[model samples]
Target: MNEQETGERDPGSGERVHWSEDGAERSALWRSESGARPPGKLAVADDRMTADAAYKLACEGTALLWRGDYHGARQLLAALARRVDRKPPKEGATPEESFHLYRQARFRRARVLGMLLVPLQISHEGTHSAYSVPLRRAPEVAQACEEAYGPPGEELTLVSLRELQGVLGAHEWRRKGVPVEALGGDRVHPRHGVFSPVRGEYVGLVARAPLPPGEPGSLVAFDIGTGTGVLAAVLARRGVGRVVATDLGERAPACARENVRGLGVQDVVEVVSADLFPGTADLFPRTEAGADAARADLIVCNPPWLPAKATSVLEQAVYDPGSRMLRGFLDGLAGRLTPHGEGWLILSDLAEHLGLRSREELLGWIDGAGLCVAGRLDARPEHPRATDSSAPLHAARAAETTSLWRLAATG
Candidate 1:
């Protein structure tokens, strides 16, 4: 979805399309004020357009409306993907350089491929006139489209094939959940916009790390930047007396709340909306005592591992601009610890390996914040990227180890 995704159009990026609104042909440069809208040059295509021509137009950032067969569009998309994968980036001097370049190339590839468009029929009375597109063998995607984009605003609207694919994928994931071994093999179904904790290494570290010494009934933990509430649920299952999880995104807090409710840990876990921590100067207010007492026996944060700007809302889970969340968590760690209590910082060495951040700078931030590394647990990455020989970043991936640094306040 990247920058092409729906929302306010960048000042000069939008152009009008001529289509019939009533009996007369009218011109409307349609732009979604909000929502995931695909950005590109658009043209209406019937069954006459060939796959080769469609591929060329898509590569040039042109979206084609399918007045064509439904199944044919799917095949054309596959052909376009094949072309994209065939052209790999040239090798770089180091894996780090190669990894960065590979990412850039992949991103552009995705942005272009996403230009393939799908049409939805929006009836005047606010219901779909036909759930199926003009294409043959297309499933009843009306419900899925409505669920993803909300009710259509006009007689017709365009959605990128990639976006619809995401909707369908989310539906499948919601139907059959992802298994989190940390939650005693319980399934955690992630809603879109919420990062799924399928990465076992980090969650494994959270599950296996020693619990701080305290009466079992009095232990409280905070799940900072909680996405799907997987960590919060894991904490609650491990018998933490209370777990408070916070997220600022419109979707994440609700997603986390649902996960907590579904896991039956709603009684022990409270999902709240906050930018980073529960209390911040501009957003939320608390008394000095309130802030002091809110410090928990444990605070856990797994921020975006990469230090890059996220162009879209969804990418926020993978890229943290200027290491904002990571630095914030460290800067506030000492203030939010209960004297003897610990802050569990779950991080990966990927950024350092990628030459994005340094070990000395990270240590300096910790010391500058008056926090010290107490004990650390490390786990090797088990994801496919670690062993994919064909992947450009395989070298960096092989050496990656995610760690949970037990941080304590320095006297």
Candidate 2:
């Protein structure tokens, strides 16, 4: 029999009913109080409600008070997902349109499913309540929280159910690894806060482009802002004798090192921690070693594509805010290059399509830096987001193209 049928009424209704004093029973009471409920509707007693039933009810604007085991609710939510995915696709839609619709639908579905993850708060009495969510995978969550948020306190600790799921997903991605054919049947596992080279179109361009006429393996390339070290690995595989991968993030230094080691390129690739160019002090030679510091025969950089502020450190790989990294790299290009050395800047024109920046402005920057575009190679992004029209910037994405700008120092 369900908990409600034995003479229970809505607690808020203040009707007298049997109240269990046991800690287990009290825990159930706590969940009912803190569980998600649809706005402006009275929650009635129901014990047999499954997570799927609850999700469906919530989607249809109904609320479920979970009286089952906490872990059981998670399983129920998973079942609900199967039902949603089983539904047929919408009719009369093009592939591009369908792709966009799928992303939107998936996003909405996740948001709804996420609501079912109610937090369980542990109290000092060896009992738990639902006033707030206790950290999941508490040790790791606590560490990440400490890094992102300050040390924990009695501030009613909270985190987005969605973001927690994202962390778990990222962990899985790191474990499984990302495949790179350019690395000769190898895969690179990028850690959290590091860039993942999922789309290979740009990397392919670099791998296939002819090196300046010289000894086939004579080139020494510097991969500036090397996040996951994918580009550096690609260059190494392409027969570059030496590669130096640089990044400023503490996490990135270790991440790049791991990736470099994983792809078996550690012998020729050195991952260094630095902002912009390394081994160059103050842009002028202060010492003889600094003066003759190894100049790159082929310098490559894949700067953050968009011109916007990063919301978090993790977003730094995707957002360049003020085009600072791109501009800085361009301004420093002349000094860092060997005679006749070419700088390959892999970039996207999504900003222009989004009305955020103009192509002329970009060209102006290149010219102002005393560098001239020697030649350019172009490719289309193959990320699923490109074809997702329902995305906020779909119109801009449809018109975007990625390019490898071959630049030569004019000064």
Q: Can you list the residue pairs that collide in candidate 1?
A: 6-37, 69-135, 70-135, 70-136
Q: How much lDDT does each candidate structure score?
A: 0.74, 0.66
Native-to-model Cα distance after best TM-score fit, residue 275 in candidate 1, in Å: 0.6
Task: Residues 307-340, candidate 1: write the lDDT tens digits.
Answer: 8877555678889989999999999878887767
Candidate 2 lDDT score at position 295: 73
Off by over 4 Å in 2: 1-158, 280-294
Model 1 CA lDDT for position 88 = 59
Q: Estimate each model's TM-score.
A: 0.86, 0.65
What lDDT score goes with residue 265 in model 2? 88
For model 1, state the Cα shift of residue 302 in Å.
Answer: 0.6
Instruction: State how far residue 206 of model 2 sits from its true place (Å).
Output: 1.5
